[model samples]
Target chain A: MDRNLRAMASAAQERGLALRPHAKTHKCLEIARRQIELGAAGLTVATVSEAEVFADGGFDDLFIAYPIWPSPGRAERLRRLAGQVALRVGIDSVESAEALATAVGPLDVLVEVDSGHHRSGVRPADAAALIEAASKAGHSVRGIFTFPGHSYAPGAPEQAALDEARAMVDAGPHAEVRSGGSTPTARLAGTGPVNEIRPGVYVLNDAQQIELGTCDWADVALTVHATVVSRSGNRAIVDAGSKVLGADRLAWATGFGRLPEFPGARIVAQSEHHATIEFGDEAPPARGDILRVAPNHVCNTVNLADDLIVFSGGEPVDRWRVAARGANT
Target chain B: MDRNLRAMASAAQERGLALRPHAKTHKCLEIARRQIELGAAGLTVATVSEAEVFADGGFDDLFIAYPIWPSPGRAERLRRLAGQVALRVGIDSVESAEALATAVGPLDVLVEVDSGHHRSGVRPADAAALIEAASKAGHSVRGIFTFPGHSYAPGAPEQAALDEARAMVDAGPHAEVRSGGSTPTARLAGTGPVNEIRPGVYVLNDAQQIELGTCDWADVALTVHATVVSRSGNRAIVDAGSKVLGADRLAWATGFGRLPEFPGARIVAQSEHHATIEFGDEAPPARGDILRVAPNHVCNTVNLADDLIVFSGGEPVDRWRVAARGANT
Candidate 1:
């Protein structure tokens, strides 16, 4: 894991925010352990596979922050993990809460409130009804949370945070621990009822972050290493492709990915194993020059690699295994 | 491997077209070995990793169908593999031909001509330039090929194949083996200069094929088995997401994936592991019912799994390891 995690944690402390870094971004045990050592209150996960990884690494506190459906088989796993450490989960609806009531241990449960993203989660007004249902079913309600995913848009973070905080307040005293904000919206949501912040992509900001104006190019901590294989005038081909970087073409994305060093270049197209680049009329990269490509979406990119080559100040340092690279189950 | 692969081969042989099944669709040595036993002429691949898998399994003849740029390291691997088998590769640019000259041994090389896909490959007129470059480098040009990707559109296969055939013929007399056609365009190509066809997805048709009216739902050999985890009056949650089926959203796709058994239900939203579904007043499925989901794209869905469960008449017959599940390199 990157040793600079301590520095990031200290930065979070200065900002007066409790860091519960989302483990779904890296999914490495070493990184999770270090995050805990750096004073992270707990770990946030998107899936059970990620929770399993952190739990096996001996980390205690875990919060799966999705409106997850607790299946019997998976609920058994969660119960086992709950016995080992402090465990919390999220629910968005009365139906999910009712189903989870039978499966989950008497653990801290948060209602996923839809602040802005219009994705999973209930409206703030619906939180009380769901929480009441959970309480009636003998399940403990801990707090309410929302992910301002729409805050990722340029200049939308502040207003999105305000809207989220206001919505959480509208839930009144029932919504005590109002958890809101992602990395992009963290600064805007701090020092409010949304006391806790979960920022997964902050550790390794990506092309999307750059586009969102949340981070500088220098702060990006991860990149896909590719070798130039073919050069045709302004066009060239690199070894990394959709399988490596993922063919996720976001509507406003500048390119498939960005060459961190060669900021002038953009990935024009990608096949499964080869990425095509249009580098204008400049001299194409030599056939063996290894290029560092920063993917547009870091979460999916990390899932593609079996291991990550950790670096500091442009020098290769250590190799961290992506333990749960494709743990879909 | 799929036990019914032999039956699939029999169906193909009845059509008078030899099957050189693309291993890219399902990168498994066990599957490749079975295909060979069932009378597959050779193997087709999109990556060198796939080719290595088949070659290691002792399948001799292999064709890498992508217009890949062979790096020195990859070229060395190709040369080594070439020494062990009859290897043919696709090239679209003069630079790729030069790199191949330096790396590849005496092997058959095909020039990929752009019929209409507009992805990779050169224009029909540019094929001569690439062919001349390859010939000058002592690499014998085998033929010209096109993908006719435009065939995915409704009623466009026949016309796209006609254009593709014209492009191949326009590539001069050196282009002997005019290869074209996928499963959708196989019959529409009309078998002119196209001596061979590579249709890997025919064995397991997907939503894309079904939407294009290429195959019936019964022909789909693969389906994602997901379990319901939560249910309301009409809404339900399942334990499958983008990590399982992939987040490939085609414009013509019918939702993220199709539930063949529960045709009324649709995957409304997906997180990493949780798939939120809206039943909309329909009696919700019981929490344990296994929903068979037909993915929009079978090629990517197979890449996501660690093992493929082969079923004969609905009983689990065998399990084939996805040997090259994350073989991005």
Candidate 2:
């Protein structure tokens, strides 16, 4: 975990980009503190509740990188969060910008420009208008940001980084803090107006990262320690399933998760508490045998766990609470 | 929730089958209490930790329906729980049966037969061998159970129920309390030797249940109240995503989740905190608009939430803690 953190920190520092590691992956106070100690500019969270959790933990600067629509209750929470820390929110629409300003008064905002993920955010041309709208609503438009989530595909990281840079550049003069980059595109984010990168999964690279060629198996720091409960021939059922490893299989994903030790094993079926793994020519695991299973997505997997059992030199070390887990308000 | 509970309770009563609703769905003590009041025989849980949670809540009769391979720590927990409650656990393998008996001492055990799911459980022919092994190890063999998880498909419930009953009947004379049934197959169970139904999701029908023609929209007791965060054309991003609604998309699932208010809309894509919905010929939801979404699978969804906001006639009444939300041991 320290190696991955330092690698990303130095990589960002080398590229002259501010590292605002997304806290949604680890959601651990200790890891966040370590990131800050290693010179992370700030933390990037996904929700108001998450920001509140981190703020309560003494991390001052935080950014909610999603285009959040503040309801009456969330507005009050956002207001309280802004009063405690340097808060930056993502804005992709004029209506939300106006609503947020009205609900919580003027705040630090970033115009979200879509760079081909097409999940959220606005067009590059629409960034200036939304920034103007947010500015008109008495909010300070710090800059623009994009997700580049399309980089999650097998061979799409470099092109996604290019797209992210192009989108930030095309968004015109509002690119002061051109924030972008997920784990896949973070290293390739030096070009164009991009000045900040928020990579969440680099701290705990998972099966997806390894499969995407973004990180190697040695770089993975988090794994679900599962026990083989039942076995028939090469098929074994592990206790850690979607309930622990999470059920976030992408269209291109080979299986629900991957067995790091048994490279030929594939988790073909997963229920809430049982993951049925089809093993290759390797000897099948017997009942009660413990196995380290890598989740497809670290973010979802971490969200499921209450605490991470930190390991050092093949020994159990400490337990880090997933403090902001289930804080998805 | 009351209506759905009453309906399932009465359905089980009519068939002369004990209704042991799986507590893994709600994970709420308040709801579990209500289930007991509605004549549910006992509570069925997925994990030893979950069983312990219910046991701690004062409910005595409990069953861990998975083929659990108890570690030393879990074995101790099981022994403690067995002393506290009328505990019964499932066993599908001779190794696990002997291990469980040796680790926790003689306890009530159920031979798990593979009805049709093929995920866990031994074959019907192998059930007697497991039961004999448990009995020989000085444990009380308490009949058998099967999941019939294949009932989750669109047109497979009836056949799955038949398979469950047939498997139990073929498992020999040890079938005293033949336990089976999921939400889809609960109503269809009654033939052969099946005498108990462990339907988890019947209390809160989700999009999958409705899609499978198992339950109606009115039967859906649980719905995630989310806000529209971003909108572009017909696509609107909601606050609830895979983190809250869960990411269990079966092969035949229509979408990630269903918006009850806008039946035409479909949750096309979901990130950790964002669900992009594509509206079908309906007025696009504006930012900050609250929408109730029924998840693809209620069990996975309930596990993600910290609490369930009880609504009495459209007004928030109480907050029930998800007591065993992450009790996956």
Candidate 3:
């Protein structure tokens, strides 16, 4: 984890870009503090509750990087969080920008420009109205931000990053504090006018990263320690599944997860409590054998774990609580 | 929820089978207590921590339904829990059966038989060997249990139930307390030799259930209250995604989730924090509109939340903590 954090931090630093690592991945205060100590400029979050957790944990700079709807309950929390942190929030529409302006007090806002994911964010051509609305509502507009979420595809990282840059170019004057970066496309961030990069999964490269060729096997820093509970022919059942590993397998991915020890094996399927791994004709791991399995997506996987059993040199170390777990409002 | 509980409870009662609802669905103490009050024999859990949670919540009878690995840490916890509750664990192989017998104190165990899901559990023909191993290790073999997981398909419920029964029959004389049931196949559960049913998702039917014709729109008891955060053309973004709604779209299931408020809409894509619902160029819901979304899988969805906002008569009624939210070992 430290190696991953240092590598990403140095890469962003060399590119002269601000490194605001997304805290939504680990959600651990110790890891967040370590990231900051290793030169992360700030922490990026996805919800007001996550911001509040970091603020309560003594983090002063926090950004909620989602096109958040400022509901009454969330508005009150955002209002309180703005009083404690150097807060930044994102919005993709005029109405939502106005709602957030009325909810959170004196915060910097980023117009969400769509780069290709098509899940949220405004089209580059539609960023003006929301930027104007956020500015008129007594909030400071800090330029545009987009998420290159489409980079999760096997060989689409380069194209997705280029798409992000083209989206920014299409939104000409709104490119000052442009921020964009997914773990799969982090290397291509500085190729555009992006001044800030927010990469969450770089702290814990997962199966998706390895499958995307974004990271090698040695780069994966986190894995689920699963125990083999049953064996039938070549199928080995491990006591870890969607509940522990998270269910974010992209359609093109290999399987449910990846086992570093048994690289030839494929986690064919997952129930709530067990992952079915097929080792083909090879002798399956003996029942009661422990294996380290990497989840498809580390962010959601970390959210599922209550705490992480930190390991060093193949030995157990400290434990870090997932403090912001289930802080999704 | 009350109606769902009563309906499923009465269905099992009329079939002369014991109902031990899987708590992995709701993960709420209030719901588990109400199910017990409605005549559920016991509660079924997926992890040792989950069993501990129920036992701590004053529920005496519990079953860990997965082919559990008896690790040192988990064995210690299981030993502690065996002293407090009527515990039953499932095993599918001689190695795991003997390991579990040596780990926990004298307790009943069920040999897991595969019922066409092929994810976990041994073949029904292989159950005798595991049963004998458990019996020789001083553990009581209660019977055989199989999860009819394939019932989640659009019209496969009846066949899954039949397969469950056939698998039990193949297990010969070890079918004393044959157990099986899934949300979609609950109605067809007792058509064969199953004397006990463990249906979890019937407590809150989801999009998979609705798509499978297991339940209708009105039967869905749980829905994510999401706010429309962004709108563009016909696409509306809601503040709920895999982090809240869970990412469990079966190959034959609906998009991501089901929105009853707009029958024509389908959630096309999901980011970590937003679900993009396309409303067919109908200008979408205005920003800040709250809508209830029935997730593709309710069990994993409930595991993602810290607490549930209960509703009755279209108003907020109570709040319940998801007691076993992250009890994944």
Candidate 4:
């Protein structure tokens, strides 16, 4: 885990870009502290509740990299959180900017642009207009940011990095801190207009990262330990299922998850407490044999567990609490 | 919620079937007590930790309706729990039966037969052999059970019910208490060898149950409250995503979930904290507008939240803790 964190910090340092590792993946205070110690500028979170959790842990600098449309209740909470920490939020629409400004007064904001992911954020060409509107609403418009989510697909990281760089460069001259990059596109984010990169899953790579060629098998730091409960022919049913591994199967995912011990095995189906794995050519493990299974998405898996059992040198070390496990508000 | 619980209890009573409501859905002590008050025979849980949670709540009669393969740690816990409650566990193989019997003394065990769901359980023809092996291992045999999970598909309830009945009958004359039925197949279970039914999602109907024609819209009791954060053209992004409303999307599910307010809208994409809904013909909700969304799977959604806000006559009445939210040992 330390190796993965140090590698990303060194890569960001070499490119003269600020490393603000997204804390949503690990959600552990110890890992976040390690990232900061390795020269991270701040921590990136997905929700206000997550930012508050880190703030409570004595982290002063935090950024919510999400276009938050605060209701009255959330606005009050955000105002309280901003008072405790150096808070920065993302904004993509003028209506949200106005509502935020009216509710929480002046705050640091960044314009989010769509760099081909198309989930959230405005078009790249309209970033300047939103930035101007946000500034007029009594908020500090620092710069622009975009997430290269399209890099998740096979052989798409290079183009996604280029698209992220192009979108930030086109967001006009007022943009000083252009933030972008996911795990797949972090190192590929060239030395251009982008000055900060926020990568969440680099700290603990999962099956998706291994399949995408973003990380090797040795780089993975987390895995679910499951025991084979029942078996028929080549199929082994594990006790760990969607409740532990999570049920976020991307369209391009090979299976629900991957068994690092048996590369030929695929998790064919999963119920609440049972995962049926089909061992194609490998010998199936006997009943009561425990195996390590890597989840397809580490962020969702971490959110499901109350505490993670830390391992070092093939031995149990300690337990780390998922401080922000269900901070979804 | 009371009405839905009562209706299922009444249906099971009229059919002369014992309604052991699966507590994996609600996971709340209050609801489980209510089910017992409404004449439920006992509670069914999916994991050992879940059974431990309910047992700690003073519920003595409990059934772990899963093929549990206990490791040494879990076996020790199960032994302690068995001493406290009238516990009945599901066993599908002679290996698990022998191991369980050796680890945790002689206990009441039920043979699990595959009705149609091939995830776990043995074939009906082989059920007698396993039952004999379990009895030889010094455990008391308590008939058989099968989960009609295949009834989740559209227009599959009738066939799945028949399959369940047939499989239970084929388990031989040693089977006295034949347990079967899911939410979709509960009512369709005819008078046959099956004498008990377990339906979890009937307490809180979800989008899947509504689309499967098993329940009406008014039967749904749980819905996620989210605020519209961003909008563009026909798409509106909400704050509640997979983190709040779990990411369990069945193959036949129409979308991630459904919006009762806007019947024409569909949740197209979801990240950790953002759900992108596409409003087809209905006008998109403005930013900061709160909308209620019904999850595709209520059991998974209930597992995600720490507590649920209860309502009575459209007014917030109380808050109920999800006592077994992460009881996935």
Leading candidate by lDDT: 4
Model 2, runs deviating above 4 Å? none
For every candidate, give the share of true A-B contacts it also has: 0.23, 0.92, 0.80, 0.85
Q: What are the runs in model 4 whose C-alpha is more than 4 Å off?
A: none
Q: List the residue pairs that clash in candidate 3.
A: none
Instruction: List ranges where model 1 is wrong by over 4 Å.
Output: A1-8, A172-176, A228-234, A262-265, A280-290, B1-15, B172-176, B227-237, B262-270, B274-290
Task: Write candidate 3's Cα lDDT for A1-329 as tens digits.
Answer: 88898999899989988889999999999999999998888999998888989999999998899888878888888888888888888878777777776666557888888899887788888787767777898889988888988888877999998998888877645456888888877778764577789999999899988888888889898999888888778988888888888887789989998988788899988878888999987989898898899999998998898888889998988988999998888
Worst 10 residues of 2 chain B by lDDT: B168-177
Per-residue alpha-carbon lDDT of candidate 2 for residues A48-140, written as tens digits (9 for 90 to 100): 989999999999999999898888888999999999999999988888889898899999999899999998889998888888889999999
Candidate 4 DockQ category?
Answer: high
- Report every candidate's CA lDDT: 0.76, 0.91, 0.86, 0.91
A160-252: candidate 1 lDDT, tens digit per residue: 878878777765345556777687876666565677788888878788888888877877878888877656668777878767786565557
DockQ (Cα-based) for each candidate: 0.37, 0.87, 0.76, 0.86
In order of appearance, the predictions have TM-scores of 0.90, 0.99, 0.97, 0.99
TM-score of chain A of each: 0.94, 0.98, 0.97, 0.99
Superposed model 3: Cα runs more than 4 Å off: A173-175
**TM-score for chain B in model 1:** 0.91
| Comparing 2 and 4 on lDDT, the stronger one | 4
* Global fold similarity of model 1 (TM-score): 0.90
